[model samples]
Target: MKGFITDPLQIERESMRIIRGYLQQDWTEKELKIVERCIHTSGDPTLESVIRIHPQGIEAGLKSLQQGAPVITDVEMVRAGIAKKQLSQLGGTAECFLSDPRVADQAVELGITRSMAALRLNKERLKGAIVAIGNAPTALLEVLELAKDPETRPALVVGIPVGFVGAKESKDLLWEEHPELPSITILGNRGGSPLAATCVNALIYLAVNREI
Candidate 1:
């Protein structure tokens, strides 16, 4: 039997080492951290195949966080998972709009999903902010539509909603229709709040360490 591993730092180090063994190609240090965290969060090594990163996504996200950009999330779970301390140390903050009263009211009034409504309500704040969507594909769709308007463009979008319905389609649209947008995403329906949060946290770590 294996001995108990009580050190959290050592646990993480060992986990990353295991994940590294699964990766065949060599990725940059920053890119490897992002991938490792995703695998660590999901415990699925095959996830590496679906991950897609815009060439400038990491650098853009890091720059935004360093400049004190707000990080917007589609779900509270994602917001809660972010390393807020590290983010604050780098002059950034994370927020989730799903619980906003305005979003609830608007969803009912507009006959849209609360996630979609939430994104619409926060359109102004999304500009130049790092947007992370880990639930509700409708939210990702809304973000893409809003991004078409220059004033609502985000610094970097981490699109990884998980579901059977719109999740795959939403990510496909983000990758295909809006290739110009700075973003990171999993290509199919294999994503969730944890994966999205992991991506943002990796970027924050990169920013905090001045690696970007």
Candidate 2:
């Protein structure tokens, strides 16, 4: 949100503080470029100019600011990044932009699975309980009890795997079948612990914190 053209050193200092953890991500450089360009090109508007910048540009600007570099932004590029049709289709309420359906569905299903695992502690290495098969009902009871604790809940969950085989069906299941939950579905197929989890966890945290 902070947009200005200060010395490169100052810019880097601010970026370090604002994007402390994400500075290592792959998109950090792109973001830095965008920010630097936007600020330098737009002159000095402070907060009143309502300067528009792409998400990537904003990110780049932030990074440049953090790295203490001058930013020169292209407003046209930022405008192009906005998905007008997609935004209209979702009524500006949802963030699901994936063309593949399975990817979206997998996100929801994965979250459910993770939440269940966290609730039941179903993994083999779990340290909670050691009971026989006959004690199944008791274990279920314990799981229900633990689910009440807020700390154990999943903070966020996301799925944006590219080339998702059944993305359409999965997305339908979430939006059409179960629409109560707050979720974010992505497009493409490149998922793992860091990016996907980061997005999901951030979303969950925001939802829990009432940001979404």
Candidate 3:
């Protein structure tokens, strides 16, 4: 069993060891002490990683995750492997996105980008499954109806084009019918293709960060 130490230096040393293991590297003694002191004062392990990541990088990284669609990582794959065994834990099998050309572009961008990132990151398996749909809001209702079997989980819908005729309504109706649907983030107004790409990239960054 592991033993706890009362000495601040020892505690910091232990934390440094833990951090090194997770970061897959050795830390310089000078850096270790600095990191350890931060931990000692803040009492937050994340702070150590945050320091390594730096504020600008953290902000950019966060923006990438929250604004984009969905992505998976190798960690997620392993998690999915375990989850796949249970009938109820099967990740989403269906997806919905706006049918409007503009709206569809956003949904597709987010979906494709997320898939690419997830493939590269080796997500946590269980938590890494991300679903992307390209159907408008109204179309999503039909998708929900089609995916209603108790065995299949509701699809995650990304609604980026808020005013694409039936698209916005589709999102609302989808929420009403399948409240458990998983989605990364929602956009309130209609966005162009460039915006859609940015959103998708953001989602990929966010999902990977979430696993890390």
Candidate 4:
């Protein structure tokens, strides 16, 4: 009978040790923390190949968190996954508008997904905020469109929506065409709320630890 590791801190240390042993890339310290958290969340070390980071993404994220910026997410799952308790202490907030009646009504009338309407509805709150999208490609696409203007641009975009439809295309567009935007994403159509949340959590960790 084999014994499982049950201690919380020990588990984290062990998990990170193993993850680092398997991950070998030229990523900076902050980038590696975000990648490791995603890998830990999924229990998949091979994810190192898919995790993409814009050079300024980590820097932007930390700065925003330090400045007490808000986080606008695409769905409830992403919002729930964040470290809100710790984040609030840093004067940061997280919100999701998909559940708003206005989003649903606008989506129905405009023939758009609720996710897209959600982003469209929060242009003002999005400026200088962290935009974390994990489940809806439409929301990510819409954010990119709005981001064309400085007023709606986010401090950093965590665009990692998981699906077979527009997910891959949306992420590819951000990575390939929007190089100037600070963003962290998963390439090739594989992402979810856990990854998105972990990415932000990593940034918060860096901010708290002053890693940058």
Q: Which lDDT value does model 2 have at 52?
A: 21
Q: Write the per-residue lDDT of candidate 3 for residues 95-173, one digit (tens) a residue.
A: 2122223443443666533323332222222132233223234333433453454333322333332356765565555
lDDT of 4 by residue, 68-94 (tens): 999999999999999898789789999
Better of 1 and 3 by lDDT: 1
The predicted structure with the larger lDDT, 2 or 3, is: 3
Question: lDDT for each of the candidates?
Answer: 0.91, 0.28, 0.35, 0.91
Badly placed stretches (over 4 Å) of model 4 are: 210-212
Which runs in model 3 stand beyond 4 Å of their true positions? 1-129, 133-135, 161-163, 184-199, 210-212
Pairwise TM-score winner, candidates 3 and 4: 4
Strongest candidate by TM-score: 4
User: How far is 97's C-alpha from truth in model 4 (Å)?
Assistant: 0.6
Q: Write the per-residue lDDT of candidate 1 for residues 1-212, one digit (tens) a residue.
A: 37979887888888999999999666888889899999899999998988988989999999899899999999999999999999999778899888778988899999999999988987999999999999889999999999999899999999999989999999999999998899999988889999999999999888878332
lDDT for model 1? 0.91
Mark the 10 consecutive residues where model 1 has the least summed lDDT: 203-212
Model 3: lDDT equals: 0.35
- lDDT ranking from best to worst? 1, 4, 3, 2
Q: TM-score for model 4? A: 0.96
Supply the global lDDT for candidate 4. Answer: 0.91
TM-score versus the correct structure, for each prediction: 0.95, 0.24, 0.31, 0.96
